[model samples]
Target: MEKQGQRCSGLVLVPCPFQGHINPMLQLGAILHSKGFSITIAHSQFNSPNPSNHPNFTFLPIQDGQTDHDATSTDFISLITALNVNLVFPLQESLAQMIKQEEKKERITCVIYDAIMYKAEEAANHLKLQTIVLVTNSAATRLTHFTYPQLQAEGYIPPKDSMLRDLVPGLHPFRFKDLTILNFPNLEALLQLIATTIKIRTSSAIICNTVDCLEQPFLAQLKKQYQVPIFSMGPFHKIAPPSSSSLLKEDTSCITWLDKQAPKSVIYVSIGSAASIDGRELIETAWGLANSKPHFLWVIRPGSVRGLGWRELLPECFKKAVEERGCIVEWAPQKEVLAHVAVGGFWSHCGWNSILESICEGVPMICQPCFGDQRLNARYVSHVWKVGLELDNELERGEIERAIRRLMASKECEEVRQRATDLKVKVEHSIREGGSSYNSLDDLVNHILSI
Candidate 1:
């Protein structure tokens, strides 16, 4: 252990209280470890049970032994309300003091903090160490969050109740006909977002997981406005090995199965770790996948069943019909699944990590955006990236079936797949040895040393 006392580069990685954030942080941690940094990753006590987190990674559980009210779960509202430093401060302080004890031999040289965990910033400042903020989302998403006030004023956001947002300048001409964030925010939701946006901007330097090519226009604008250094060294897992994707337990079988199918012939469906669907919708989706007659793999969470009673979530008939074509699991090796030759397309929630992964894997998406900036990502995938189609937030089986068929059997799908392949090449180049991301990491390391 490269603890304090020696002159090693001791580092701490603080991810927000969520899986989406945690995923990227882990990848970066792996990279840092490969580059010789001693790493400490803090996990919320809330997520202690998850097996997906790496065992070798140092784990600091926040909110340990707390009730549900104090834990941070998948529910966005519940998490924001339940989590606080009161629940996490002890761990933070202890770790800091431990560092102090070891500073002579190998110093706790710097911090790589999550932008959401602003308290980590204070901890770094108190310790008088250089701190860099990791913004795991895309450049555009960060820019949107940062510029929410302006978007609200321009009427692009706080969108009229009838449709999708249509007014962000220099962005896709989107109209929320797809049941987007237009449900209108409750007062608390509005306030929380505003607070988060303001707090995140306070970081000393920002590290985003995106490349310059993907969102250069927006990234350039943000770089110009901020005084601190902004680096784009992302799609961080472009050629990642499938060590810890969702389907870790079953990835080998899943990929072997995919190999039996014809090339580019199957649809890989996943709605991310946190999304849940009703029984009615599940049945419809099952029927659609079956009707489309495509080889498919659908990741269904154990607790996703509706009516608060999961027994009735899947009927015997639907399951029987789709079993041969469908492979269902709580989480499957999502990255490997996407990269499979049999996986011609993807059905997803448009999560930023998922989007980047799919783009890097060269798989076209069938977007079913659920929340937050997902709608914006869906738009970019469909319009800008030219890699996928939108589910339009409609749960009907006919649309699902038709979309699958078109995605697999049409000229457009082939074109999109080809384009995705090209993008994948570019994404790989950006993260490889001496690639843009490789150099960006160097610059980041040097920046921390200078600070």
Candidate 2:
């Protein structure tokens, strides 16, 4: 009661399965918890996934305080629950009950839903929980999904082989052949993605992990279509305190390494945990960066190493080159790396979190989108946003080499860099006092409080 009295509100966030959704959603929740909202983050226990908790946060297992938290102001969770009908019911039930209980004792003002997690929103609707969908992808990507039906009707999507083809008209065309080659094993998942977009479009509210300035036109278009209100309160990032159990740990060694490099001299490369690449392609990209002779920080998740697993060995030449001017780690403090003075460009898988963070940091991209909507994001970055160059699916060192030089050292690179910096400033302003994102966030708060 006292904690509620101090903060006067609370939140419950449900994140979709997988690292991409969980990581960024967790970051956003933390920021909200800091802003005087008591938070509940629900996760599935089916995967036995770890929340890898932070202070005043939790994992909603069958553990203590899972459905019971009468604690202090700042509380958050990383939902690790499975996305099945059975699991979702109990989780949702628990959420409604928790909020009711909290409301009785104090207050839980809102329910934040993961964009594709339909069950969460259903639960929110049932309980009359003021709902907000958290879109971890670019607003443009949501536009793609929302616009998919139109695209399909207009002959932009065709049935190819066993999968649906995406005939992305302009610079790059997409087909089902690429889906299989890129390992989209689940057609059901694709349909769910499209379905999720339908829900988001008609949704009364949304909380995107983007700033309105970075995607001004799309944000405008989105508002024009569904004026239910939208908020872009991020690339919300912060430095870790020396005093807490951090959400993602940092390695200061990389910062020391970055210091030795010249200003805007290093390339930051991370495919994110969900992106996969073959060993042959990995070697190809390694050699590509080496040949470019640029300083780099490369994150190679063990999960990405397929056939032989992480046990698989890289060629000695690649290792020697990595040692020469590169730092390779399993995971990285991504936000910090982007904020660093040395990072000039990013070689990325074009995940939404990576893209938005890079944009907010004023860094341009060498986009090598792996699969999913990353391909879409890559296309927009190069063609629409004009903030990046594409590293297509050729799997060759020379192509990688050329793209790096063009992005990091050429006149084309400067144009991309300028656009990137301009967008970054714009996004920052949008979340500042009276900015669109800021105002939207406040409006969201008022709506929930009304509820």
Candidate with best TM-score: 1
Residue-by-residue lDDT tens digits, candidate 1, 1-451: 3335547676777776566877787777776766666677765666542434565456666554556755524455445534545434655675677676775545666778767666666666666666788888777766655655565667656665554444445454545432233553463475465456445444568888888778888888778767888878887675333346232245457777787888888888888866678878887888899899888988776666556554456678877887777776666777778878788889998999999989888899999887776877888889888889988757999999989988888888788889888988888887778887778878876776555
List candidate 2 segments past 4 Å from native.
1-7, 46-53, 62-82, 96-105, 153-156, 159-189, 200-204, 224-227, 238-252, 309-312, 321-323
TM for candidate 2 is: 0.82
Q: Which stretches of candidate 1 lie over 4 Å from their true place?
A: 1-6, 49-56, 69-75, 153-157, 162-165, 174-181, 184-188, 198-202, 239-242, 245-252, 308-311
lDDT tens digits by residue: candidate 2, 283-305: 78789989998888988876676
In model 1, the number of clashes is 12
TM-score of 1: 0.89
